[model samples]
Target: MTLNAETMARFAQVYRDNRGAVYAYLYGRAPEHDLAEDLTSETFVRALRAFDAYVAGDRPIRAWLFTIARNLVTDEMKSARRRRQTPLPDMLDESRFVVAEPDPAELVSAGHARDSIRSSLARLGGDQARCLVLRFFEERSIGETSTVMRRSPGAIKALQHRGIDSLRALITTGAIAP
Candidate 1:
């Protein structure tokens, strides 16, 4: 499908508005920054290629973008699993796999509260977690979140409520300190 000037402009606007949220979502799910960056880039590239097929009124653009990102991550995981094989002794390099310690300054930069919140978020169920991320972290309105999540607004509200309740319980239990 050919993308006209108007469609290209709209696609650009959508990318600009949702890029950070997409990257954050990818980072949250992926184990490393470089992997997340690669996935995020692939997400946008696929989105651009499929732009002609997207129906604007069916769902919010942000939701469509996220669906693409989610699919890409799933594909990457599958590909990794398929490529996995037993390592031979000669190919092993213990010295090359050093784990880096977290920087003290970076830890200080991310306040305790933010860390706690992230911990709690990680424990939430998939739907609830997505709702919370879209509604709170990304600052999307309920209507917008519902569109992206492909849920009714009422369902989104319920998920948000349950997610918040779970977060509170976690914090109260010191699983995630306030």
Candidate 2:
């Protein structure tokens, strides 16, 4: 599909406006920062390439960007599965979590607890991670998260419960203090 000048402008605007949020979203999904950067770039490229096909009311562009990013992550997961090996965790030491670059004011206000929370959230299995992020971080409704995560509502709820439980465990262990 061809993105005419105006559509291209709109797509670019959307990309610029929401890029950071999308990057942070992908950062939580990807195994490494470099992979997250690549995936974020691919997401924008795909969104630009598919701009003309994007209907006005199907969903917000932010949500649509996530849909694209999710597809890229899914494809990565499939390839990883075919290779058949246990992937390494990004955070081997809890100390690495504390050494993050100086955070923004909002993150500071949210407190170190949020970073701890995100770290725990990141530890969830893929579907649980997807469900938790979409429902809580992205503020998507249960139905919307189910649609994006491609699971039944019951499954999402179950994952959400387990994910929160594991996060609580992380908190209790002092791996991440609230």
Candidate 3:
């Protein structure tokens, strides 16, 4: 794949448009912000290198990029386990603390609602969580998600329905902290 001006321009456009969403998705899964940012950069770099070979077909570019992102996160999780590393909640970093910034606790509380959803989805396990993430966060349609997940549309629908039910139960039962 030639790194021509036109090609580079298109990739740049994609990066500008989707970087935030990609980072948000990664930040939710990756244990740390730095790791999330790094994974986000790697995602785009991988996407660019593979861009020439990428065929959109019925799936949008976002879904393809997310597939790459998901795989990277999975690899990172496995590597973490191999290293026997566990993520501690946000560590005390006095230097990075800024007065103007909202309190970390407050910010976390603000996201409590979102966190519960993610926590519950995670509790639902791998296939269901992946289906929900691709369907909801990446805004992929059922057909697109099926293509990305390599599942039948009917399977995707079943998974989605079951995931939603489990998530509702988790939240309603106070299984995940609000």
Candidate 4:
């Protein structure tokens, strides 16, 4: 399909609006924040190039962008497995010492909660983690998640249930704190 100025502008607007949510979703899964940001940029670039193929839907642009990002993450995971790369947890821990601007007290508390969720997510299998991210962090509806995940609503529900269960177990085990 031919690229046009209007289409490009719309894609840019959509990317700007959804980029933070996409980054959060990626950061939830990626071992390193830099890698997550890199993948998020790549995802938007890919989405811009593929904008003509995007369909308008009841779900927001973030859901569509997430589907694409999820696919990329899956491919990366497959490649990592084939290459026998270092485990995700080890990689995550290696990057945990980065410095960021100081947060306020409430922000620090919220950050702690997010860190707990991230730690629990890291323990989940890829599909489960993706499902949870889409459902919770992305705040997508069940139907939207089913579309992004390419699963039946029932299946997505089951995964959501099991994923939450796993997360709760982690919280109880102190792998993550509430």
Candidate 5:
């Protein structure tokens, strides 16, 4: 589709507004910065290609961008799992390379905390977990999250409340660190 100058300007504005949220959403799911960056870029590329088909009043722009990011991350995860099924050659064994590792006990501890939170999040219902991530981690408002999840604002609020309660319970039970 040929994007007019005005259409291109609108796309640029949307990108500027939502880029950080998209990147954060991907990072929350992917963990690796480089992988998240790649996914975020791919998400925008796809969005740009399909921009002509996008209806302005159909949904919030933030929601549309996030949907794109979520789909890319899901696809990337599936691709990674498929790649894992193939075994590496014995000659390229990582154990053969005696690389000096840095002593970062503090960093390891922080990572453990993140892992614990992720594990706790996994135990929540899909809707609840997603609401929590978009609301808290990505710092999206209730209205914005509702649009992304395709739920009403009230439903999003309820999910966020339940998700927070569950996270607190997990922390209290030592499933995750405070």
Candidate 6:
């Protein structure tokens, strides 16, 4: 379906409203800031391209948007070839807000911690890493994580437990410092 003026307006509003959360979600999984930004751009491009197929009542708009974002990250991790990232539709630039940047020293400390956690998560294997990121970094509820991951809430709970255990082991072994 062609995005009529109304759909175009709605899509633009969504891009403006949801970009930051999408960026943060990608940021936790991406290896670098630039890749997260690139993935954020690509998520909306794919969302709009596939918009015709989206049925509004199937899920919350944020959920749909995140589903797109999650798939892109997974694809990026799996693919050898890098796809070109797309720019946002024209009007999105106008409404973007500037936030003060974090301190460089704190940023370095946080980046090290994040890398350590990610490394531990990688060692844990399976969906445990994704589960922890969704639970903690993304600030998603157990039910929301279950929906996003297509797992049962019980399964998510189990993954969370296992992921935490793995992280604790890493800390104990001096794999990651407190």
Q: Judging by TM-score against the true structure, name the best candidate.
A: 5
Candidate 4 — which pairs collide?
Answer: none
Q: What stretches of model 6 exceed 4 Å from their correct place? A: 56-67, 70-107, 148-162, 172-178
Q: What TM-score would you give candidate 6 relative to the actual structure?
A: 0.60
The CA lDDT at 55 in model 6 is 90
Quote the lDDT for 8 in model 2: 78
Q: Model 5: runs farther than 4 Å from truth?
A: 84-103, 126-128, 146-162, 174-178
C-alpha lDDT of residue 70 in model 6: 91
Candidate 5 overall Cα lDDT vs. reference?
0.83
Top-down lDDT ranking? 3, 5, 6, 1, 4, 2
Models 1 onward score TM values of: 0.63, 0.54, 0.62, 0.55, 0.72, 0.60
Better of 1 and 2 by TM-score: 1
Which of the predicted structures, 1 or 5, would earn the higher TM-score when compared with the native?
Answer: 5
Candidate 1 lDDT, 1-178, residue by residue in tens: 5888998998899889888888988876676678999998999999999888888896668778889999998988888888965756776676889878899888766656666778778876588778988887666889888877889999999889888887888866845322
Candidate 1 ranges with C-alpha deviation above 4 Å: 1-4, 84-123, 126-130, 137-139, 146-162, 171-178
Give the higher-lDDT candidate: 1 or 3.
Answer: 3
Query: Whole-model Cα lDDT per candidate?
Result: 0.82, 0.76, 0.83, 0.79, 0.83, 0.83
Looking at model 4, report the run of 10 residues with the lowest lDDT sum.
85-94
* TM-score, predicted candidate 4 vs. hidden true structure: 0.55
Per-residue alpha-carbon lDDT of candidate 6 for residues 1-178, written as tens digits (9 for 90 to 100): 5789988998999888888878988998788889999999999999998877789886888788888889999998878256655767777565486868789999988988888777777776668778887788676889989998999999999889877887888855845322
* Ranking of candidates on TM-score, top first: 5, 1, 3, 6, 4, 2
Report the C-alpha lDDT of model 3 over 24-73, residue by residue, as the tens digit: 78887887779999999999989999998899898778878878999999
